[model samples]
Target chain A: MSIELEIQLVAVVVSVACSLAGVFLVLRRMALMSDAISHTVLLGIVLVFFITRDIASPFLVLGAAAMGVATVGLVEALVRTRLVREDASIGLVFPALFSIAVILITRYAGSVHLDTDAVLLGEIAFAPFRRLEVGGVDLGPRSLWVMGGVLLLNITFIALLYKELKLSTFDPGLAAALGFAPGLLHYAFMTLVSITAVGAFDAVGSILVVALMITPPATAYLLSDSLPRVLILSAVIAALAALVGFWTAWLVDASIAGCMASAAGVLFLLAFLLAPERGVIAVARRRSRQRWEFARLMLAIHLLHHEGAPDAANESRETHLGEHLRWEPKFARRVVSEAADEDLLVRLQDGRLELTETGRDSARKAMLV
Target chain B: MNPLRDLLFDYTLRTVALGAGTLGIVAGALGTYAVLRRQSLLGDAISHAALPGIVLAFILTGMKSTLVLVLGAALAGWLGTLVVMMIVRHSRLPEDSALGIVLSVFFGAGLVLLTYVQKLPDASQAGLDSFLFGQAATMLERDVVVIAVLGAIALLAVVVFWKEFKILSFDPEFGASLGMPMRSIDILLTTFLVIAIVIGLQTVGVVLMSAMVIAPAAAARQWTNSLSVMVLLSALFGAMAGVTGALISSTAQHVPTGPTIVLCATVLVLISMAFAPERGLIWAAVQRRQQRRQIRADAVLGDLYALAGHHESEHAHDVTVLEAMRAGRTDVHRALDILEERGLARRDGTGGWTITRAGRAEAEQAGESGPDGQHEREGSA
Candidate 1:
């Protein structure tokens, strides 16, 4: 296969992997923590590079994953102390570690090719150049293999402990009483997040990694209420975004990572506007329609309550009902016309409107619902 | 130090220090309200969302004056927050997701605008990149004055409405019931937050400026329980972080000021989290240990009293220290030693021991205590 196809394929796999974990992270309100871990991983990378001068050493990923765990640990420690709120803890930990990394890189500038810009935003276009070989057989891109391994580990871990994870996330106190060890589960979850973040760093960089990890799951959340459905939907949405974003970047000649992030943003906006039941526009439209129908029902009920029982004489008064309802004449007429079309009302000879037997019962049922 | 000291005396360092200090104080004060309202992330979001506004301001006005840029930034930041609130109120999505959505969308638009601006044929746009990470090294006297004046205004507004802000933050529903305009007060608070953020953006940039608003308040919270004390200490801590960050960056030839300041703020937060009294990690650990020791001691004393009252006919008068220790079991030996040390037990002639006045009182108290023991006296009958 050509190098470009290999790179694109790796991108798709890694995006799905991250999005799968992103579903839980976003649901658990740990999206910013994911962002913090991705950025703070630079400290681990720089520290590892300082010790072992090889940038391609697999130890770099391990070191970065360790740093990511440390980032979560530090944030948790700070927040539990009550010295810092959660957002404040996040703000404190990542920047400090990132700056330390920058300072280390600047101080050791001569021996290292590491730069802050590159660390912050990686070169995904050049990812395919770094190949992995096993037993003298070329194994395509190394990032793809690393991410694929991590993804496999994540799937196995999450699947095996799905019930435990679900219970712990939804109710930690109850899980703890049931001997589930919430602290163990929390650390386990954070470790998985760190590993996934480190794996995706080469393909998407920090900002896009955060954006993809958060936006897809967040959007999926709007589309579904079930955890399994959210996970599946998030992965599907992320894979689609990765494909569309890559093509958009190719066509527009823009930064691929930036374009990918922008695409994720667009997906979120689309979900916000179009998702059924919970989408902004859908909810607004539903509310207005409910209000309109309620108004029509109220008018019908008022006429029925006031008019002399749906007898022959009251049916004559129903046709001249526009002046009594006190609504705009046109609007009242439109309401009556629509109600009659639904057989909830009948228009009399003198232009008044009378409620049918069906209309009275329907109005009562609507009030109860 | 020769050339560096000379440069430090120049107008640039002075202006930068002034700007950083003003921004720190203003952001620190308003941040208390932000943190209390659970909108700590709002400052971070607004700072990022202001990027497009800055670029748009420059695009429209074709000027790089500090006032115009700040005004434009404030407008964008407020608009971003307003959009976030609107999305939350109009949809079923949670507040954090709505914030994340607005933050990413605004920042993405800013990036596009920035790229376009960079391509324009304007040489004055050369330093726009510096604004993203901040370039305090290039700050002027006028910029410092602007920050100082705005900082004073924000401070005065907070002072005049301190009671209202306190009521609104603690219980907005009650405040509304008491005839307070909760919405207007919230708007006033948000306006101050935006101004504070806008000014700090020039000194600390978008990413780190949010840190300035949050870290100091967070640190100060560990040291004080009162809201007024928290706010005051937060402002002081913020100023210290700013000054120290400036001093460190200035002392080091290659260090960037914004990250250095942020690093200083992070250090303060760490120190408070680990060492502050009452709320710090170390303090909580010590408290837990002390409570365990007290429980052990109380258990030993209670056992001694139970043994003493076990029989009235056999050795009804007193018991030997050895017998008391042995009867209480192996776990009570260390606790007996502690009780003796605290003068809660006394040894009589012929190796007999008896409960001292304090020991009897402690035994009675332990008997009256409940399961959780810490609040036994007040909560128990």
Candidate 2:
């Protein structure tokens, strides 16, 4: 495969794996945990490299995953103290660990080629150079193989534990009562998140890992309510973002991971503005429609209230609709006309308004509710 | 003494350390409020969001002055926060999700701009990436002056609105009932926080700036309960970390000043959590242990008091009978030895213990103190 193809493949696999875990993270309200994990995992890799003196050790992955879990664990411990909140705990844990890693790199491992810059802005372009070979057969880019394996692991975990994950995410108490052990499931899921973050770290870097993980799942969440649909939509969105981000990077010759993240963000914004049910436009339309219906109900109720009272004629006159109801003339006219068209009001021969039987029944029901 | 004077008065080191110290104090003061309001992550978001603004400012003006870049960063941070507020108000997403989204998206945009700028014709643009990880060693006297000025403004704002900001952090509803402009106070506080984050960008950088804002305040929180004391201590701790980290990093080879300062702050946090007088873990553990010992002594004293009720002549109780009174306790002898040491009881040389005159007085004290024991347990730790 071409190097460009390999980069895109790596991006796709990384995004899909991250988004899959991102779905659960967003659902469980642990979106920032990925950010924390992505950062502190740098410390893990550095520590492991110091021990093995080689960057190609599998111990690095193991160490990164361990550090990810350690980050979550330490944050939880701090939060449990009730002295600090979750967000503050997160902010405290990762920076301390990441800074330690950075300091260690500058102090002990300066002779090594472990640059902090690479951890932040990963050179996916270099992925093509780090070829994976097995039995003298070239297996394309190493990042592609590593990310592909991680993707398979994620798919297998999600598929096998779909129901458990859904139940735990939606309602943990019920899951626990059903013997699912939500706490155990949570940590297990975090471990998977850590592993996936490690795999994506080299391809997209840490911050973009967070962007790809969160943005796609969040957009998918805005688009769908069902867990299945959300999962599927998130993967599709991530894949599309990967492809588009690659092309944009190619066009602009900028940071490929950054462009991919930008593409994912763009997709999220589009969904935010245009999703069918939950989009901003849809919400505004529904609210305004409800307001109009409410005004019409008020008109019906007002006429019903003055049906036989003294000064009922003056109050019910269409000309007095704005004055008595305290509405704008145009607004009053619109409500009255719409009500008439809906057969909820009638113009009396004496030049006063009255509610039809259906209108009166509906008005009483609205008031009762 | 010569070495100390040289370290303190050295021009280059003094500039870097003084600049970091100023940034530390401002961030510390503002961070106390941020941590109290549970808006600590807001600092993180604003710092990341400031990146695009920083890049855009360089692109627009092509000037790398501290003031221009800081102004750009403050504007960007403020705009990002405004967007965050808008998202929270208008969307279904929660605050953390909104914060994460704005933070990542803006930083990505900044990265895109940064890469573009790196390829531009101007070599001065190369310094822009340093704003990410920070290069405290390169701070100029002019940069120090900028930080000092901005830091003074933020500090002045905090002092001028102390009562109002305090009430806003603790209770906005009450402040509103007093006819104060709650919204304006909120905006003013956020503006100060943004300035605080922006000023530190040159030294701590965007990635670790939030740590500077958070760690000092958090470490100070472990030592005090009053807001005023917390703020003061936070500023002190921040300045200490700043000066110490800068000094150490300058002396050490290859160590970056930002992370070293953060590491120093973390060290303070660890020490405070473990050993602070009132709220520290060691204190809590010690208090728990002492309470357990006092309860055991009281039980044994009470047991002896009961055994004395059946005595006619000597008021001596057998050890076996005392053990039977508090059944299943293997530590009964040890309890007796503690009481004996306190002059509350004495061994009668026949595997029995006699309650002394002082022991009888203490038993009565323990008898009358039963209800207060509940209060003491409630108040101890």
Candidate 3:
């Protein structure tokens, strides 16, 4: 495969792995936890790197995973103190940890190749050069293999614990009572996410990790109701975004990660506006339809109630709706005309409105219900 | 030494410190509102989102002036915030995910622009990425002046719209009922935050700037419950952190000023949480310890008082029922020792204890203090 194709594969694999975790994260209202973990995991890598002085020793993954769990635990501890709110706690912890890592890099190991910019901004174009070797046999890009393994791990984990994770995410109290240990499951999942983030960090950068993880899953959430569909849909969306982002990067001669993130944003915006049930336009249309239906019924009910009253003539006048219902003059006129058009109500020669039999029956039913 | 003179005497050091301090004050004052309003992470989103604006501004104007960059940043940050609000209002996606989306995507876009600009022939984008982790050491005198003027404007707006902003923060529904333009008021308040964020982008950089906003107000929150005092103390802490971080990074080798400022502000947060008189964790823990002991002592004393009513049962150890009250507790002996130490009970040579007149009086007072214990237990949860 060409370098471009390999780069696209890495982006797709990384995003798929991230979105799998992202699905659960979004449902748990802990999406920002991924954000916090991704940044803070750098501390673990930095700390472990100082001891080993080898960037590729594989200890860095352990370090990153540990710090991710540590970030969750520390944030929870601070929240337990009730001294700081959750957002403030996350805001406080990540930067403090990330800053320490940055300082360590700038101060103690300035000459090393552990560049902060690459970690955040990502360099997927260069992935083809970092080939994996097994017994001197040539393999493909290292990032592709690493991310593919992480993706496989994610799928297996999700498959094995689907029932438990779904139960815990939707209703934790029930999961806990059922002996699933939601808190323990949460920490375990976060730990895996940390490991995945460290693996993907080389391919997509930290912030883009968040973008791929959050935006795709969030868009899928809008497009589906069932959990299984949501997961599958998010993975597909992630793959599509990766492809589009890679192509855009090639077209613009820009950062691939950025292009991918921008693609995710554009896709989510489309979902936000055009989804079947939950999109803005759909909701707005539903709301307007409901308003008109209610207004028509209300007009019939008003006329029926005053049909035989002593002030019936005054109450049935077209002006009464604007006065009593407090609707705008234009809206009242439209509702009046629509009711007439539908034969729900008739306008008398004197400009009094009267409900027909069908209208009266419908109004009575609405009142009964 | 006069601190002001010493601080302002050096051109480079003074510019860096003043610039950071100004950013701190604006962010600190505005951040108090952000924290109180539970929009703390909005600062993070705005700061990160401002990068594209910075790069875009430099690209559009072909100038590297702080004002132009700040203007670009403010507009971009404002747009990012509006998008977040739009996403939350229009869709079921919660605010955090919306924040994450805008923050990352905008930063990604900014990096794309930054990379594009670097490839250009002008070379004016040389210092553009400095807004990433910040280069406080290279902050110019002109940047300081720009920051001060903007900081003054934000602070002034905070004062001018204090009442409306306060109502908007605490109870927007109530303000709207009273016919205040809550949405416009909210926009104004957030706009100030955006300005503060853009100003600080040149000092703390995009990644660590959120800490500058949160740490100060959070620290001050521990010190006071009053909004005015919290805002004031927050600004003070922010300024102090800014100056201190800038100074340390300048004096030391290999310390980045932005994170140093953040770490310094974090230390203040830690101190406030641990030691602040009203809400500090240590103080609460100590009070809880003392309260528990008081409740325990009261219970044991009341036990002695009630047990005293039984005939000739003045000696605690002699009473088998009191031993039954022990119920696997070595603390019973400890409580007895404490009572004896205070002369509330006397130890007989036969290894028994008797309640004194003082113990009886205190037990009567404890029984009278009904519901005090109830309130204390309720407060603990």
- Local accuracy of candidate 3 as per-residue lDDT tens digits, A60-86: 889998999999999999999999999
TM-score of only chain B in every candidate structure = 0.88, 0.91, 0.88
How many pairs of residues collide in each model?
7, 0, 0
**Best of the two (2, 3) by TM-score:** 2
Flag regions of model 1 displaced more than 4 Å: A1-11, A82-84, A128-145, A148-185, A226-229, A307-331, A364-369, B2-10, B59-62, B121-123, B179-184, B282-381
On DockQ, the stronger of 1 and 2 is 2
Q: In model 3, what lDDT does residue B82 have?
A: 97
Question: Candidate 3 DockQ category?
Answer: medium
Candidates' TM-scores?
A: 0.85, 0.94, 0.91
Note the residue pairs that clash in candidate 2. Answer: none
True contacts kept of 1: 0.32
Candidate DockQ values, in order, are: 0.37, 0.66, 0.75
The order by descending TM-score is 2, 3, 1
DockQ of structure 1? 0.37
